[model samples]
Target chain A: MIEHIFPVHPAAIFILGALVIPLLKGRLKQIYLVTLPVVAFVNLLYLPHSVFWVHHIGGFELIFGRVDSMSLPFGYIFIIMAFLGALYAIHLKGSGEHVAAFILVGASLGAVFAGDYISLYLFLAMMTFSSAPLIFYRRRKSATGAGFRYIMFHLFGGSLLLAGIVLHYTFTGHTHFGPLESGGLYFYLVMIGFLVKAAVPPFHAWLSDAYPEGTATGSVFLSAFTTKVGVYVLIRAFAGADILIWLGAIMAVYGVVYAVIENDGRRLLAYHIISQVGYMVAGVGMGTQMAINGAIAHAFCHILYKALLFMGPGAVLYVTGKEKLTELGGLYKTMPITLILFMVGGLSISAVPLFNGFVSKSMIVAAAGLQGEAAVYILLVLASVGTFLHTCLKLPYYTFFARDAGIEAQEPPRNMLMSMGITAFLCLFIGIYPAILYNILPYPVDFVPYTIEKVVEKIALLSFTFLGFWLLKDKIAGQPTISLDTDWFYRKAGTAFMWFCRNPALAFAGWVDMTFARLAGGFLWFCRNPASALATGVDSMFAFVVRIFVGRQRHSPLRALKSVVGWMDRLSLAAEEAAKRRAQREKMAALAQGEVDVRGIDSALFLVALMLALFLLYLAVKYLW
Target chain B: MRYLNNSEKKRIVRYRKHLFYLGLLLLALLEIFIPRDPYFWFDGLPVFYSVFGLLGCILTIIICKTLGRYWLMKSEDYYEE
Candidate 1:
C-alpha cells in the first residue's frame, strides 16, 4: 500500500458528500452517492495504522485527531459498512434520508477517529442528532412510536454525557482522551450516557423498539455503525475502570434473556447485538493487554456478523414484508442463498469452533477466565449458550428451516443479496483465519483461538446445545410477547401508574362538581372564604403570620373557620356513623389504587392517618419555603 | 434403505445410541493422550484443567433449552394493545 500521513481523511470528504447530497435532490443522486463512499473507503485504506491530526476551531485546540490500530479497524469497518449500506439503500427512492444516513455514518466514522476528548465529544453529539430521522425511516404509526421512543432515550443518554463532558471540561481544562489520573462523578455520568448507545441492560428497550420498525434499508445503516462505535469509545476512554467487568457481565446475561424471549425475528437479533458487545466491554474492563486485544477483535467481528444478521432479516422484510418469528418458517425452500448466508451469520455469532464469533468471543471469555473472574466466566458461558439458543439454532431453524409456516418469500433484490453475501463471506473468512484480524489488532496477539482441547470443549458445548434444541423444538409455539425489561418503568408501570394516580382524581373532582352544581354554587355563595380557599390545602405559615400582624381579613373569618372546622369534624365523625357510606368511598378510591383492601379500614386507618399527617406537614413546609 | 423386522429396527436404534456413548468414551481417552501443544499455530492453546469450559458449556445449554421451553414464548398480539 502507498504510505501517506493521516491517509484516512474521513471527515472532509464525507461532509462534502453530505452537503452535496441534499443539493443533488432527485437528480443524478446515484453519482454523488457512489463517489462519496468509494473515495472515503479508498482514502481509509491508504492511512497508516495509527496517525494523529490536530485542527483548531476557534479556541479549542482539539487535542486528538489521530488514528491508531484500534481505530484503524473501527474506521475501516465504518467505511466498508458505509459502502455496503449505501449500495443496499440505493433504491431508498427519497433522497433526504439517504443524505441523512450518509451524514450519520460519516459523522460517526469521524467521531470514532477522534483522538482527543473534545473532538470526540463534538462529533458524538453530531452523530446523535444526525441519526434521529433514520429511526423513523419507515414513517408508520409503529415507526412513529418506535422512533419517538428512540429519540427520547438517546436524548436522555446525551444529557447524561453532556453532564459528564461539562464536568470534565470545567475541572480539567485540558480536553484529552486518555487515561484519567482521577475521574470521580464526571466519569460515571459520561459512562452511563455512553452505555445507552452501547445498549447496556435496562437502557436497551429503545434499540429493539426502534430498529425492528425502521425502513427495510434504514436498518442496514443502523446495524453497521454507531453502537459499536460507542463500545470503541468506551474502550478508549475508560478501559480497566473495574466496574465495567460486572457491567459487561450483566449486559451479557440480560441480552440473552431478552433475546430468548423475543418472538420478533429482527428484535431477537437486536438483543444479541448488545449481548455480543457486552463481551467486548467486559474484556476492556479487564485492562490487560490481551484483554484489550480481545475486546477490539470482538467488536470488529460483531459489526460484520451483526450486519449480516440484520441484512438477512431486512432482506426477508424487503421480500415478504413480515418479521414476527411465529409468522415465519421454512423459507430456505425459496431463498436458498439468503438461508445459507443467514446460517453462516448464525454460526459465526454462536461462536462455533472456527467461526467469526468463535475467535473473538472466545478471546474475551478466555481473558475473563485468566483474569480470575469466576462469576464473569460462568455468566459469559451461559450467555454463549443463550446466544446459541436465540441466534445460532433458533434464528436459522425458525426463519429458514422450521415447520412450514406457509410464507414463501422470493429472493431479495440483487444489491441486498450482494450486501448479505459480502458480510457472510467476511464472517467465514475471519473465522477460519482470525490471524488476519489479529495482526491488525492494536495490541500484540499472544493468544491462540483454536486447539484440539479448545475445539473439543466448543464442540461438546455445541453438541449439548444441539440436543437442547432438538428436545425443545416441539414447544416452540411462540408469540410476540413483551418481556418485563427495565422499560417497565416508562412503558407499563411508570407511565400507567402516573396516569392511574392522576385520571381518577381528576374525574372524581369533575363528577362532584357536575353532580352538585347548584349545591356547590350555593357553597361558593356561603363561603368562598379566604381561609377555606387558602386552607383548601394548607394555610401558608407566612400568610398565617401576616393575618396575625395585619389583622386584615378577606372573608367572614369566624363563620368560615367554624364552618370548615365543623365540616372536618363532621367528615371524621361521619365515617363511624355510616358503615355503608364509608365502605362506598373506600371502594371508589380502591378502583384508583388498583387494590386497596375494602375490609381493613380499622387497621389501615392507623398507617393511613400517619401518612396523611406526614404529607400535610410536607405541604406545610413546601408552602412555607 | 434396509427393510428389517420390528425387533431388528429396535436393535439398530440401540446400536446407534451405543455408538454415541462409544464416541464419548473415545473423546475422554483422547483428552488424556492429547498434549495440548499447537495441533495448529501456537496462540490460544487450551490450557488444561479447563474443565470449567467443558462442564460450564454443557450446563449452560441445558439451562437454555429449559428456559427456552418455560419462558421464551408468548402470543403474537402481546404488545399490540
Candidate 2:
C-alpha cells in the first residue's frame, strides 16, 4: 500500500478553492487559480492506495476517498486537465467562469473517488449543473438555448441514475459501488444513464449540440470532463457488457459519418469526440486486462489531445470571432503556431505514429482483432480513416490552408498558446513512451504498439486515406448548412411542446379560469342582496311549475307564489328601514354613518341563515343515510 | 504573414503535391518489405490496409454526403425555423 501524505479528499481542494476565487482579483486570482489544480495534483500523488475516509450515514457507507489504480489514472488526468484549462482561461476578467470550472473539476474528481452510489449520484448531479455554466457563459442566443438543452439532457440522465441507484439499494440492501449484477431493470437503467453521459448515439446529440456553443476556453474544459467521466463510471460498473461492444463499434463510425459534412469547425471536433470515445467504450466492453488498460490509456491520452483540438478551434474563434469552416480559411499564414499545435492534436487523434492516440487507440483495435471480432475491427478502423479524413486532413485543409477567405486574425493570448503547447508536448511524450502511461494502468500492461508491421500498416492506411482525400477533397468541403442528428427529434419536439403550451394548454387554462370567474361573479351577486335574490329565484321556479300546470292564469299558483315572494322581500326591506330609523332615533349618527349599513347587514344575516339551514339539511341527509 | 514570401510559398505548394505522392509510394513499398503477423483472414492479404483506407474514405464520404443531401442536411437556421 502506498503511504498517505494527505488524508483530505482531492475534490475538496477544488471545491473549497472555488469559494476563494470571488475574493481575489487580477494577478492574484490567476495565481490562485493555477495553484489549485497543481496543489490538487500534488495531493493526489500521495493518497493511500486503499479506500480510506469512509463514513456512515443512516447505516450506509459514504466513501469519499477511494484511491486505487482505476480511480488514480482518472484523478491524475482530470487535475492535469484542470491545470491546463485554468491556464488557458487565466486571461479572463470575470470570476464566475473560473468558479464554475473549478467546481466542475472538483465534482468530477468527487465522482471519480466515490465508493458508494449516493456520493456518486451527488457528484454526478453537481457535474451536470457546474459544467452547464461553461456553455451558458458564452452568452450567445444559441449558447443559451444549447445550455438549456444540455442541462435537460443531463438532468434526465441523472434522474435515470438516481432511480437506478434507489432500485439497486432496494433490491440488494447495500449502496456499495462496483461491478453490478447484470440482467435487471436497474442494470440497463444504470448503463443507459452512463451511456447518455458517454455520448453514445441516440443519447448523443446533446454533446454535439452544446459543446461547440461554449465559450472558447469553456469548451476546452467541457471537452475534457463530462463524457470521460461517463466512460469512467462505465469502467467501474458495466465493464464486459456485450451490448456496449456493438454500440461502441457503431458509434465509432456514426460520429465520423456526421463529421464528414459538418460545417462548424468546433462541431466537427465534437463529433470526433464521439468517434474517439467509441474506441474507449469498445475497450471497456471487451473486458480483457489489456483492453481495460487501452480504454484508460486512450481516455488519458484522449483528454490531452482532445483539449488541444478544442483549443485550436477555440483560439481561432477567440481571435477571428468565427467558428464555421464556411466563414474561415488561410489562417495558417497568420496563425502558423496555432496551426502547428493544432496539427499535433489532429495527428494524435488520427493515431499517426509518434502521437499519443497511436499508443492507446491501437490496443483497443488490436484487442478486437485478437478477440476475432472482425466486424468490430473493420468498423473501428474505418472510423479511424474517417477521423484522419476529417480531423487531420479535411479540417485543417479548409480552415488553415484552403482558398483564402481574407479574414483578419492574429494569434490568440499567450496563455492559450502555452496551454496548447503543454498539451501537445504531452501527446507526443505519451506516444513516444507508452510505458509511463502503461505503468499507471489498473491491470498489468502486455501490449506493444510500435512493432514494424503495425507502423507500416498504419502509415500505408493513413497515406492512402490522404490520397483519397486529395482526389475527392472538393466534394467534402463544408457547406453553409447543418447536419441533423438524433437531436432533431428533441429540438422539433421542444418546438411542438412550446406550441402546445402556447395554443392548446393556454386555451384550456383560459377556459377553466373563465368558468371559475363566472361562478364567483354569480356568488358575489347573490351575497350582495341575498333576501331579494332568493325571493326572485323561488318566484321564477314556481312560475315555471305553474306555467306547466295552469298556463299563466291571473289566480294561478304562480301568482300566489310571486305575491308571497314579494311579501318576503318587502318584509326584509321593512326590517332594514326599521333598524335605520331606530339608529337615527337613538342619535347614533356614527353607527348610521359607519358601523351600520342596514340593508347590507340584513342581506348578510339572511345569507348566513340560509347557509346554516343548508348545512343542517346536509347533516340530516348524511347522518340519516 | 511575414514568415514566408509569395515565391517561397508557391515553390513549397508546387513541391508539396509531389512529396505527398512520393510519401504514398514509399509507404506502399515499406508495407511490402514488412514481415507479416496476420491477426485475421483479411490481414494476410497484401496491401489490404491501403485498399481499405482508400475505399473506406471514399465510401464514407459518398454515403454520408448522400445521407446529408437527401435527409439530414438542413439550412443553418433549421432548428430556429
Candidate 3:
C-alpha cells in the first residue's frame, strides 16, 4: 500500500502563476516562467504516494488528491516531462508562449498526481486550456486554425465529461476513481470523454494538427504528457472494462494507417502517437493483469521513444525551417547522431525484436490473442505493418537517408540532440531488458516480454514488412501528398459551413441580423406609443425584440393596428346604422388565432406608453439596448 | 485552377497504374484454388495486392478538373498571392 499524502490545497498558486506569466515584465519574465514549472514539479513530488484528501461544499464531500499506487508512474513521468519541456522551451524566443507551455505542463503534472476525480478534472482542464498557447506558439495561419480546432474538440469533450460526472455523482455519490462497481451509460460516457482527449480516432484531428504546428519544444511537451495521462486515467478508472480492448485495437490500426499516408513528417509522428495509444487502450480494455501491465509499461516506453522521434524532426525544423519529408534528404552526413537516435525511436515504434515497442506491443498482442480476439489480432498485425511502413522505414528513409537533396542541413545543437539521444538509448535498453519496466509497473510483474517464440515471430513479421518496403521503396519516395481523414469533414465541410453562413440564398442569418436591428428600432418606437395596456397581454411582444423579422411578421403588426383602428372609426360612423341592424343583428362568432380588439384603442395607446417607459428604464440600467 | 499541378497529376497517373496491377494481383491470389500452383499470378504480377484501393486517382482528377476551377484551389501561399 502506498502512503497517504498532503490533505488541503492552495488554489492561489496556480491562478497567480497563470496571471503573472502574462503580466510579468521583460528580462525577469523567463526566470518566473522557469520557476513556475519547477515549483509545480517539486510540489507534486512532496505529496506522499498514498493519500486521500477531501473538499466539501454545500454539505457535499469530494475526496481527491489521494495518492495511490496507480498515480505513481504517471505522476513521476509527468513531472519529468515538465522539467524537460521547460528546459526545451527556455531557449525559445517567444518568452510568453514558453511560459504558457510550462504552465500547461505544470497543470498536467498536477492532473496526474491528483487523488480524486474533481481535482483531476480541474488540473486536466488547466492542461487542456493552457495548451492553446502551444498551438498558437508559431502564430501562423495554420497554427491559429489548429488551435481553434483543438479548443473546439476539447470543449465538446469537456461538456460530455461534465455531464457524465454529474450523472455518475447522482448515481454513486462518491468520487474515488477505483475499479467499476457500478454500471450504466453515465460511466461509459465519462470514459469516452477521456477517450476523446486520448486522441482515439474520430476525435484525433486536433492532436495531429496542433502538435505539429507548435514550436519544436511545444511538441516535445505535447508528446510526453497530455495523451499519456489520458491513457493513465483509463487504466486507473476503467481498468476492469471490456470494450476498450476493441476500441484500442481500432485506434491502433486507425493511427498507423493514417500515419503511413501522411506527408508532413511531424504530422506523421503525431499519427503514430495515436496508433501507439491504441495499443495501450486495448491492453487496459483487456481487464487482465498482463494487459494492464502491458498498457502501463507500453505507455512509459512510448512517452520516451515518441518524444525521441519528434525531437529528430523537430531539431530539423529548428535548424532547417522545414518539416515535410519531401524537401529533406541526406542529413545522415551532418545529422548522423539524429539519424541514429531517430532509428532507435523508429525501431522501438515498429516493435522490432529487442526494441521497446516489441516488448510492450507484444504484451498487448499476447493479451488480446489470449482472449481470442482474432479481429484485434489481425488488425494489430496490420497496424504493426503500417507502423513500420511509416514511422520506422518511411520517416527516416525520407528525412535522413533518401536521395540527397543537397540542402546543407546539419546536426542539431548538442543539448537538443542530447535530449533525443537519451530517449533513444532508453528505448533500446528497455527493449533488450524489459524487467526494468516490468518491476515498476502498478501490479505484480508476471508476463515475460522476451521469449523464444515471441522474438522469432516479431522479427519475422517486421522483417518481412521491411522487405515489402524495400521492394516497393521506389514507388513510395520523394513526394508530399495529403492523406484523407476526419479532418476532411472539418476542412471541407467546415468551409462549407462558412459558405452557408455567407450565402444569401437560404435562411440568411446575416440578413436577419440586419433586419433584426432595424425591427428592434421599430419595436422600440412602438413601445413608446400609447399601446401599453393592450400589448401587456402578449409577453411575446416584449420578447419579440429577440427575434428577427420574418417575411409575414414584418407587415403583420402595423397591419393589425391599422385594421383595428380602422374598425374603431367605422364603429363610431356606423353606430346609427348598427341600431337599425340590431333587429337583423348578424352576431357572427369571431374565430381567429389571435385576439384583436377594436374598442380598446385608448387602453392600447396607454399600454404602449407604459411599456416604452419601462424599456428605456431597463436599457438605461443595462447600457446596451 | 486552370489545370491540375503537374506533380498532383503525376500522383493520379501513378495511382491508375497501381489500380490495374493491384486488380491483376488479386485475381492471381484468388487462383490459389488450383491443384498444382503454376505460380503464374505470383510470377506475372510486379508488386501490388489488389484493387482493394479507393479512387484517389479518380477523386484527384475530378477535383482538379471540376472543383479546382471554383474552389479555393490557389497557391500554397494563397493569401500572400
Candidate 4:
C-alpha cells in the first residue's frame, strides 16, 4: 500500500489545499491552512533526489518535481516559514488572505522544484499573480494604489521574463532548465527580470512601497518568498555573471543608506531586506563553490531573521495600530517580549556574533576576499557597518528606548509571539551551530565562523559602530517624514498620464472628430447633391467671366457666354444623375424611418438592384486590394 | 512601565548605558591581543574593524542627513497626498 502511494509535487499540496479554503470556516480553516504547509514539507521529505511526475505537453517536458541540492534548502525554508506564518496569522478571520498566501507559497515552491523552463515560467507567473492579493487584502486606500503599482512592476518584470523564455526556446530549441550562459539579449533580459524581483535598485522601489502596506501576517509571508525566489532563480541560472557582482555590491550599500533615513519601522525593515539579500546576491555573483553555498545558506538565514524582523514591527502595528518610529517609544516596558524577540532579529541581521547572519554572511565576505575583488569586499564591509547603524542601533533605540511617546500599547496575541519565537530560536541556533545550515549547502561543509579572531573582529566592529551611533545620536534621530526614492518617478508619471487622458487627449480627439465630420459634409454636398452646387457654380462663373471679358472686348464676352452655355448643358446631365441618387438615398432613409412604403413592388425591386450593385463593388475592391 | 518602579527603571536605563560603555572598553582592550593575520593587509592594522565601523557609521549619518535635508526627506504624506 505504501509502495503504490504516488510521489506528489510539494507545491501541489498547498495549491490543492488553497482551493478548498473558501469552503471551510473558523477552526476548520485554521487547521487546514496550518496542515497544508506541514503536509507539503512531509511530501518534500518523501520525494527522492531525482526528477519525478514528468508529463509530456506538446514537444516539451513539464517537470513538477526536481529535488536537488539547489532546490531543497529553499523548499525547506519556504515550507517552514509558511507554517510559522500560518501560525502567526491563525487569529485572523479572513479566509481570502490564507487562500492567496497559501497559493503563493505553493507557486514559489513549485518554481523552486521545477526542472524545465516551461514549468519554471508557469510557477513564477503564478507566484506573481497569487501574492498580489496579500497586499490588496489590506483594503486601505493607499493599499489600492500601492497594490496596483506592485502588480504593474511584477507584470512588467513578468513580461520581460516571458519574452526571454520565448526567445530562448526559439533560439536554442531546448526547454530544460539549468545554469545558462551570460550570452545574448535573451539571457540578460531574463536576468533583468529576475533582478527586478530581487528588488535590485531602480527596480527596487516597489518592495519598500508595497510591503509595509500589507496585512501584518501577509507582510511576514511576503518578506519570506518573492525576492528570495528571484535569488533562487539567479543562483540556478546566472551564477558567476560579472554584472551581478557589481550590482549586488551596490544593492548592499544602497539599501543601508536608504534605511538610515527611513522612519517607518516596517518600511525601514523592507529596505533592509534589500540590504541583506545583497549578500546572497554578491555570493551568487562570486560563483565559487563556497560562495554559491554561502549564498544559499545566507538566503536560508535571511528568510528566518528577516521574517522575524518584519513580524516584530508587524506585532507592534497589530497592537498599537502604529508603525512609524517617530510615533513609538518606551515600548520595552509593556511589550517587553516583543522587544526582545525583535532584538534577536535585529542582532541577527546586523551579523552580531552568535547570530545566523554572522555564520552565513562571513562565508560570502570571506569568498569575496579570497576571490581578490578588493573594491567589492570593502563596499560589502561598509554596508555591514551601515546595516548595524540603521537596523540594530537606530531603529531599536528610537522605537523602544527613546523618550516615552506616552501611547498605550501592549504585546500582540500568543500565536504571533510564538511565530516570532520559532524564527528567533532558529536564528540563534543557526548562529551558534552553523553546521545544521552548512550541511544543507550545495557544496560540502568546510567553513568555520567561530574562531577567536573572527569573533573579536565582529565584536570590535559592532561595538565601535554602537559608539558611533552614541556620538551621532541627535543627527540620526527618527523623524515623522518620508525619504523619497525612485518610486517618485512612476507616482508622478502615472498622475500625469491620468491628467493627459482626462483633459488634453480628450479635447484633441473631439477636435479631430469635428474636423472629420465637416470634411465629410462638404464631400457629401459636392458628390451627392450637386444640382444646387452646379447652378450656383454656373452663375458665379458667368459673373466672373463678364467682369473680365466684358471690359476687355465685345468678341471675348460673346465667346465666353456661348462657352458657358455649352458647358452647362453637359453639367445638367451629370446634375440630373446626382439628383436621382440623392432621391434614392432619401427614399431609403424614409423607408428605414417607416415614412415611405417598402410594400410597393417597384420600390422594393429598385432597392434590391442597388444592394446587389454595392455588394459587387465591395467584392471587386476586396479581390483587387 | 507596569513591572518596575520609576527609580528602578531609571537605574536600568543608566546601567544599560554603563554596560554599553564597558563593552566598548573591553573591545578596545582586547584588540591588543588579537591576531594581525587578515585576508586584506589594510584590515590587518590594529583596531581596523573598530575604526572603520566608527567612521562608516558617522559617514552614513552625515550623508543620509545631507540627502534628507536637500532631497530625500519630505512630508510623511508625500506619496499619499
Top-DockQ structure, candidate number: 2
lDDT of 3 by residue, A1-625 (tens): 2345443232234445666665666557656755765676566656666555565633345554556667766665665555555545555555566657656755765676565666677777777878887777777978878887887778888778778777877888876666655478778778877887788877787788789988787888787777888898888788857778888888887776566456689988998899899999998888798888888888888887888888888888988898888898888888888888888888888888888888888888877777777778767766777777778887898888888878777787766776676677778888888887787677887777666545544554555465456656655553445555576577776777655644443334434544686698778877786476457646677567545454345367887898789999999878975564433322211222135574596589689889978885875666533
Who wins the lDDT comparison? 2
How displaced is residue B16 in candidate 4, in Å?
5.4
Per-residue lDDT tens digits for candidate 2, residues A1-625, read 3453545788999999999999999989999999989888878877879998897655678898888999999999999999999999999999999999999999999999999999999899899889999998998889989998999999899899889999999999998999998988999888889999999988999999999999999999999999999999999998898888998999999999999989999999999999999999998999888888899999999999999999999999999999888889999989999999999999999999999999999999999999898999999999999999999999999999899999998999999999999999999999999899999999988889999999999999998998899899999999999988999888899999878866667556655755686699899999999999999999999999988988755688888999899999999999997676555444533333353354785699699889978986886676556
Task: Give me the displacement of residue A588 in model 4, in angstroms.
Answer: 32
Please report, in order, the local distance difference test score of every candidate based on alpha carbons. 0.75, 0.91, 0.70, 0.87
Q: Which residues of candidate 1, in runs, are more than 4 Å off?
A: A1-8, A22-35, A48-53, A493-625, B1-33, B36-81
State which candidate, 1 or 3, has the greater TM-score: 1
Pull out the clashing pairs in model 4.
Answer: none
Q: Judge the docking of candidate 1 as incorrect, acceptable, medium or high.
A: incorrect
Instruction: Give the clash count for model 4.
Output: 0
lDDT of 1 by residue, A1-625 (tens): 2533445468767766787776674437866676788888877777765545675544456644477777888877787778778777776667767877888887887788787766776677677666767866686877866676777788888888888877887888767776654458988888888888888776777777777787778887786666788788888888898888998998888787777667788888888887888898899789888889898888888888888888888888888888888788889889999888888888889898767999999888888877778788878877887787678777778888778878857898887888788888888999999889999888888888887777776665565566555666654434556555555456665466567666676557545745586587767855767566666446577778878999855587897888799999998787775665446556665565675565685578678779978886886676545
Docking quality level of the chain pair in candidate 2: medium
Judged by DockQ relative to the true structure, which candidate is superior, 1 or 3? 1
Summing lDDT over every window of 10 consecutive residues in candidate 1 chain A, give the lowest-scoring window.
A1-10
Model 1's DockQ score: 0.19
Please tell me what DockQ candidate 4 reaches: 0.73
